[model samples]
Target: MSDTLLKPHPLDEATYLRSLGPGRLAGRTSAAYWNMAGPFGGTTAAILLRAVMEHPDRRGRPVAQTVNFCAAVAEGEFEVLVRLVRDGRSTQHWLVELVQGDVVAATASTVTGPSRETWSHRPGAPPPMPPSQALAPLPTEGRNAWLGRYEFRFERGEPIPGRASAEAPAPALSRAWVRDAPPRPLDYVALAALADTFVVKILQVRGDIPPVATVSMTTYFLADEAEMARQGEDYLLCTADARAFKHGFNDQTAELWSAGGELLAVSNQVVWFKG
Candidate 1:
């Protein structure tokens, strides 16, 4: 128990938050958090969303966003360039790119739309799972540092080390309750990051934690500010499943739900994995 271990995570404060710059926004990298490769994809996504949210010309709220990982990000200062694609009466679109030392690490497209009321019907079924309090907390000992920032109460698919042996292979699905540890407010930026929080789908299905990286990720936001606030810091029900795995690549889909049975966001990604 030392003061060094008790300090807030670099990302917990202003790490991903960017400052306005000449032609592009500028931001610093987090020194305390890193995955097997580079900075966590969740923080990367949050920064991309922050670029759009802070843009002077940005209109409406976030509806959908897609981030493509082009290369590994360097651990230092980076620049984010955003361009307004289309500005409609009710909706707006944007394109963003994050660059570090002339290398484009990530690119994204975001769509925002004003809120309106109309007749609507949801055909989706409610989330079928036990309460968050009923689930057991997953152990995190030797995993990436970023995984330790969030609390996961897993209903299934814990990715225990020995469970992935050749004799007993876990299913390719994960159902869990997830949320930030210190209870941050729910917003598009936070939710966008959370959408990518699930463990890579390939590991759960293939029963081995191999090298994994998300090549591309697309997310659709379903809830508004009210619904997001209603959920608060309560654990969100989340599930991720691999749809296909072939040729060193896999496609996965994920969904996040509110405690009161509301769909918060849905995400799909194509990931590169090693056997």
Candidate 2:
């Protein structure tokens, strides 16, 4: 891992939240900036969730979040405003806005829970690959920022040729092994930040032109950090659909797994392609 990746101190929920007070409205950028691709939708969402989890009322439960990217935000100082949409004994809903100047760059809705049904099911797992054989070495330098903090090995497919070529067809699917560099166990917030890593691969396989920038991502945390770390490995399987459409938008679904093959979370996003 590079020294820059190791620079930011790991923060628990409380400390991270406290850092965002009045004087600290502008947020910290992640090491994965280059891999962020389009507008920082995932970063905006992650920051908002960090704020929500930092609130006094949060009880360290699973949170289901839906975020919409309304506009692009340049990397730098920004503000997040969180509102309590509803609070109940078992669940809470919050609305968050990511702001830069007068613009609402992104908006999100979050639902935190204390109770939910036990029954669970997920789509079929991706084909298995051994951790020892599959782990890709981390790149010494990255085209985008986030690549520095992670060691990523693509298990399937390749990056589309050229940066702006929309003429190429999207691949059907892609898989990758991802681990944090200098390997520290990450809490839900940190893991959520990593989950945004899925977008680049999804777009790589989704269309010939690869305009699949993330519009929003919704994640549900299913287990604790210790459990996630215990699993030994993390794999991301991204599949996209070109069919579902609304208001000129399309949706793609992604599933994440621990090394033990347990389902970690599911993400769905709306993407708009540039013509």
Candidate 3:
């Protein structure tokens, strides 16, 4: 095969790893997902999860993952160390750390397990939105590189910096159709990264970028492998909103629904900010 055909996709390249030893791997940040001060938080989370998923003892699929941003990850090589906290018959718990030099830049915990057949129901329905083709994708030219990685079609609450002020605070709510720009198939690693694409909820309310960092984020994957496979290259309906912004911190929640209206994932995050 030609080398060109063997090349990895940008997302795969960004999350690619080289095993240094058991439970330890090496990776480098990608410019494609760079943010203001460091790599985009989503890609950071994706690589950390990738470390665990690539582990030999890993079982089942991703069920839940929580990542804590301890320090801004500088662009360059880093190390991911994964530890199997507990390996149960039905569930496996993992602890992972992303280290650049001696400083621990980020840490994460993940849960993976097999699914059992049982009765299920989804009471909450996907929010109403026109088909993805009906709306234009958010323009990304000359914006943050990460913003261009995904195609977003806002149904409501397009972020306009400085739209909110003390006298009038806009609600921090948004609903949109979102998918990877190059249309990658849905999977746990991609889903984990996509879960973090929402603009911070506080940004929606304040309508501006502040000195903000996501301190912690948790995502729960509801779909199994078969479910994710069925969602190939299709837009997922995504919605994000925040309840309050005070004490230099805020919280946001989001939901991702498949094109067919099945709830795919739910994510919540806590962010610290400064004026």
Highest lDDT against the true fold, candidate: 3
Candidate rank order under lDDT: 3, 1, 2
Show model 2 residue runs off by greater than 4 Å: 1-26, 30-40, 115-126, 138-142, 162-170, 199-203, 206-212, 232-248
Q: After superposition, how far is residue 36 of candidate 1 from its true place, in Å?
A: 0.7
RMSD (Cα, Å) for all candidates, in order, is 3.1, 4.6, 1.4
lDDT of 1 by residue, 1-275 (tens): 99967876445553455567633888877754577878889888888888888888887789999999999988788889888889999889999999988799999999998767888788876568888788877766677877876789988877665566545556778889998765666778878888988887656665676887999999999998889989987888888887677898988889998878899899999999887
Extract clashing residue pairs from model 3: 162-207
Model 3 spans > 4 angstroms off: 1-6
| Distance from true location, Cα of 227 in model 2, Å | 2.5
Which portions of model 1 miss their true places by more than 4 Å? 1-15, 165-169
TM-score winner, 2 or 3: 3
Give the range of the ten consecutive residues with the poorest summed lDDT in model 2. 9-18
lDDT of 3 by residue, 1-275 (tens): 99966877678889999999999999999999888799889999999899988999999999999999999999899999999999999999999999999999999999999988989987999988999989888898888898888999998887767888656878888999999877788888899999999977665677778789999999999998788988998999999988878899989999999999889999999999997
Collision count for each candidate, in order: 1, 16, 1
| TM-score, cand. 1 vs. native | 0.91
